[model samples]
Target: MNKKVLERHEVPVADTWDLESIFSNDEQWEQVAQQFKERVSEIDEFRGRLDESSNILFRALSKQLELEEQLGKLFTYAHMRHDQDTGNSYYAALQDQAYGLMSILEQKTAFVTPELLAMDPKVLDALVNEKDELQAFAHMFDQLKKQRDHVLSEKEEELLARAKEALLASSQAFGALNNADLEFPTIKGEDGKEVQITHGRFVSLLQSKNREVRKAAFEAVYATYESYKNTFAATLSGQVKGDIFQAQSRKYNSAREAALSETHIPLSVYDQLVETVDEHLPLLHRYVRLRKKCLEVDELHMYDLYTPIVKDVDFSVTYEEAKQKVIEAVGPLGEEYVNRLKKGFDDRWVDVQENKGKRSGAYSSGAYGTKPFILMNWQDDVDNLFTLAHEFGHSLHSDYTRSSQPYVYGDYTIFVAEVASTLNEALLHHHFIETLDDKEKKLYILNYFLEGFRGTVFRQTMFAEFEQLIHAKVEAGGSLTADELTREYYDLNVKYYGEDMVIDKEIGYEWARIPHFYYNFYVFQYATGYSAAAALSKQILEEGQPAVDRFLSFLKTGSSEYPIDMLKKAGVDMTTAEPIKQAMQLFEQTLDQMEELLEN
Candidate 1:
């Protein structure tokens, strides 16, 4: 019999995250919201007085940052509460209220940037040097100055700002449709019992030892997606068009360029990732062949890629055991790091189980001044253990950055965000290998690592390529209909996995189901981040103390520097191909070991 998912309120109190840290009650949040609204009107007083003096500029900037910090707390608390149980109407209204306030705030403060741009460059520079407060925002001012060319006239900027909510409608619709409305048919489990498939459950089902179960789950998912293919295509097309509109409005040559420029990442960094990954496609193909050989299948299909080749090796890890193991895995990073991690574990920083109406998957999320909280639907398996460690990496990163930097620099960019998370996974994998004495378990670990690399580096690079292709197509006066998207996606799969494996026809609709494709060039960072983490983890394990120090420093630095510069300080230089090359080499080495173990 299939187990029933519990209601959010039915979950143990200890398993839920403590949102009370942000606000004791929604009544308190409402009071803060009213105060924030009144505070927002103060910006009107400094409207055109930015160039009068450094003190005036500093005051205006400080007020903006202050309001932002308060709003962050309010918004984070509301959204998280809503995510805990999407069916709760009260929190849903709270989230809507929070988003409405954000929109109002954006319109209210839209002129600040244009006014700052209007000031003379020399005058702005002198102001920064003259005022201590201004000096504090020197980096912010520098980044603003770089956008001088892109800053539109105040009227145009205001118009664009007002259209922000409308422009995001497509993405919002996709999320609602995907998460709330979409449903899959009940598929048979490994034990031949009917199991309802969910976004979270799909992953575990794909890894099942029973081929029949995996095939059923895969087909059920794609079949459901196929039914709504036209709707998804329309939503996806709207998203792509939105990206193009923003890029064109900002005077950027392409959507990819516009997205990368937000973090000051060079176009070459993206190009280099694709180039390097393309150069090493053979290693991925070799791994696919190895999978085919080990699984001993006549033909390896798309669904077979996920299940382990080695059978009957129980790698289940309870959440309690996972906590201690993760702390021990990260021990090389020093006592302070491990202690902070333990504090998070003990203080209820994680919401650690799936319930009915809970958001799918896991993430680390919180605002400045609140505990860096993580949400997980944890399973008793190695994957979930790594997921716990990964999210902790993000939380600890958040913890350190919030403590070290001001609210302005408290958050890191998406380009570098995955480094800490993936690094933790890599460290935990190393720990598992070293500590486990059984060869079969060791082989499973090795297989797990290779599979992760394939998914993150190889599969995501393919995704990055597809995103670029689709965006370029739309930009060149082409349509991104279901057929075009499906064909392109299928071709890429064949290219990446090679002719050795059979690319199922239903797999062509894969693009229709990817939530990331709507994310506008955001998928590439996964590949880049995985490569960087692979290199950094090797350094931490081999180079010891110095590498640990650098890795921790990287986490603490946050948005203080450009992601590229921050990563360079930690060790990897993303502009070069060395990191991706090294990661591929590691993948190859792991494959060789797995092959040897299987043979023995």
Candidate 2:
């Protein structure tokens, strides 16, 4: 029976996150709201005075930063409240108001760019060199110059901004449909009771030991989606076209280039990961064959892929237990790092569970003034224990950045964010394996690392490659008919999974269900980050304090440096194949170990 009543959910303590720390009461937030309105209106006070001199520019910029910090606090607190319980209309309404206010604020701030652009570049450069505070804005200002061509004429920029709501309709529509409207087929639990299906529950269902339960859940949920796939595909195609239109209008070579260039990520990073993963496809094939042999099944279908090959071993670490376990796992990270981590968890730095209508999945979030908090839907199981460690890794990273760096460099890019989180998982796996003498426990850990590679590295790369192909097709004026999309996705699956497994037709429709496809070229980072992290984790384990210091330094960086350079400092050079090669070697080693254990 579900512990949650209509008003709230009973997520495990570790699964619960703390948002109350942001604002203890609605009255406190309300006071900030009044102050925010007053401060926001003051933004125009220095507008006409901005061009007077370098001091004038700094003054106006200072005002903008003040407003930003206030607004960031306003919105983060409200959004976190809403995420805790979407059914709570008080917080939900507060969130919407904050968001609408933020949208206006964003448009208001757009003038900052045009205003800065209006300044003489030489004068601005001199100011940056002269003033420490002004130096912080230099990266943002230079980034604006890189986007000058895309900025449009003042009148045209306003026109485009005015059309933003209409232009974003397709992506917004996808969100509403997927999150609010689209129906999912219900699944039967082991108790023979029906349960509402969800994205979070979908993976849980696949891990069910009962084959009938797994098959019913898999087919039922997707079948509901299959019926409305054409609609989903239409919305998705519109989003793709929107991306291509934006990229082309900006005079970029492709959507991929436009997106990656913003982060200044090397195009070779994308290409090299695809190339390396493809080169190593046979090893994946071998893993699949081993899965078949161990399961004693002559054929493996896509649905059959998720079930574990080794015997189940329970590792139900409680919230308190997980806290200690993760600290022990990263003890090599040094005393100072571990102590800060302890402080973060002890303080209300996490919001850990799913309440009614709460958002799906997990993330670490905060503003400059607040604690970096994590949100989760933690179950009382081994996987949830790992998720606890993973998110804490992110929280600790954010904490370090906020504490050590100025607000200007407080937030890191998504590219490096995943690296920090996944590294914790790798460390926790190592820690668990070293402590457990039981072979079953060892195999369980091995299975997790194996699945991690398959899901993060192998599968995300496939999605990245597919995303590139379809976008190119769209750019070439070719329409992506549902049949063609399926065939292409299916063919790619066959090539990746190899001849060792049966390629289910339903697996082709999997593309229609994946939400990440809408994220343009974002999926590749998951694969790259995971591989880089595996190598970095190995370095931290083997090299001790120097590597640990370098890794922690990477977290402290935030946006102070570009992602590639920051990661390079952390000892994983992602531009080449060595990190990926090392990661694959570890995967192979784990696979060999698992196979030997099963044989014995």
Candidate 3:
């Protein structure tokens, strides 16, 4: 394998995303940035007059959203540029400038929500009833009204809005340290050649057939983090404190409440995810035991977890093959979906390779008016193929929503964000199962599916629990010192993985590296969303067109309805534990299939 890191400019032009669609050039972006800053203050002119007439209120709302949409495009362009090459000073400055513009815009528009909340309920309702354009924002109005207690006075709101950039500093610092600054030591690859560890390549290293290489990669990565544990802890603690402060300032009982309340999700969903997944810990333990037996190892460590238990079954897929497989995987979603998916591939909506200082992991991102472009550190493997399908799920969801809904509902809350992505993964898994005939190859695919369950469902739930524990600790006046954080994280691993696996001490330092910790109660949705998608995917597979239609409708609905209600309309009620339990049942059946294959 070529271990050379390509400079951003050296990466193939076709492999890169089309950010030029957002802004033709940096100079154009600059001119628009300047014009946007000047016009942002125009929001101030309509502020005090929101309650005067329905027409006045409509204009205020329209102007704020218009400016926000423009700001989204600017910030999206700048951030994607920065992400493609974090070491680039120009893009970094552009990102910072975009953030500054956002803060200013936030301050200017801060009065709209407060002023609307200040008006009499009857008056607000009557105004909405009066204007057809205003009716499009009925959902927004309802959300604002629900958050009445949390909406501070206009001046206070503006103060918090002004602090947005500052509150984000710790997260930004962590990103800089993790993505751009810290360097991992060279480790021997499976072939005994030295390769530098990178965020993009770390997991693939762990999946090596060579145990010693996996162990070295795992320990080397953690040890590097261990040296910087104190710095990570401080940044994480600062972020937690920031989250708590924002939550408390907004009259929330806890940071989780503040985060969840945005989508009107009941806390029970989180609690039940943890509780239900805990109940299913025995299944994870059983899977771990199966993994140990399959690998014929005396002791299974965390590093051993990623290697395929079924030996010598090649599942590597090229980027082109992945594109074809992904397009085929979603064939159940109908021709239009397939055609659009093909278009995304053809249009260069995905940035498909790891380059020097590029952001790690995969994400689907774009502004309301733009194609939902994807960022991926492409590797030739099934995991990357699955990731391709997963990200395309998000992109297609964005495509459908943007095409179907108005700007007000063009995007979705994060709660439902993973559903479309994970559902695509499920369909891809199903496609593999139906097509593959060889026992060993089928075992490889099954191993991949089970590992997906382990990672997405069990692993993320563990993250959710850890996130909850740390936030609660800070809320209880506890400090998240390095030792304290590491201890709690290690303990959670022990509880989640059970006695069948050795919980490595180096794994405790794992918390220091997770970027999601900075996202304030965001990781739990992966677990919940995966569960919801499992149920929804099963429906689409079994019930045919009606289920497909319901699922497609859910995608296009966007944020027009509450997330829970949207899922309910799509035929799954996340408020209940049934979806999660249903997902676990699927996990058990898949495990059963794997065990049967091994026995044969």
Q: Which structure among the candidates has the greatest TM-score?
A: 3
Global Cα RMSD, each model: 1.4, 2.8, 0.8
Per-residue C-alpha lDDT of model 2 across residues 1-600, encoded as one tens digit per residue: 243323355555454555666777888998888777766767776655666666777888877777888788888989877767655669867876786666666556656666667778786788777667687787778677877766655455545455555556666566556654665767678678887676556676777667788788788876876787788788778878878887886678899988788787878989988998899998899999988887777778787777666655555556678778888887878898889888877786766545556666777888988888888665556666778788888888888888888776778887787898889899999997889898877887788778878988999999999999999999998998777888899999999999989997778888877778888788998888898889898899889889988998898888988788888889878778887778778889988888888888
Q: Write the per-residue lDDT of candidate 3 for residues 245-287, one digit (tens) a residue.
A: 9999999999999999988999999999999999999999999
Clashing pairs in 1: none
Error of 3 at 374 (Å): 0.3
Off by over 4 Å in 2: 1-16, 26-38, 45-51, 87-93, 130-132, 163-168, 315-317, 480-484
lDDT, candidate 3, at 30: 100
Descending-lDDT candidate ranking: 3, 1, 2
TM-score of each: 0.98, 0.91, 0.99
lDDT against the true structure, per candidate, is: 0.88, 0.78, 0.94
Clashes in each model (backbone N, CA, C under 3 Å)? 0, 8, 0
For model 2 the TM-score comes to 0.91
Better of 1 and 2 by lDDT: 1
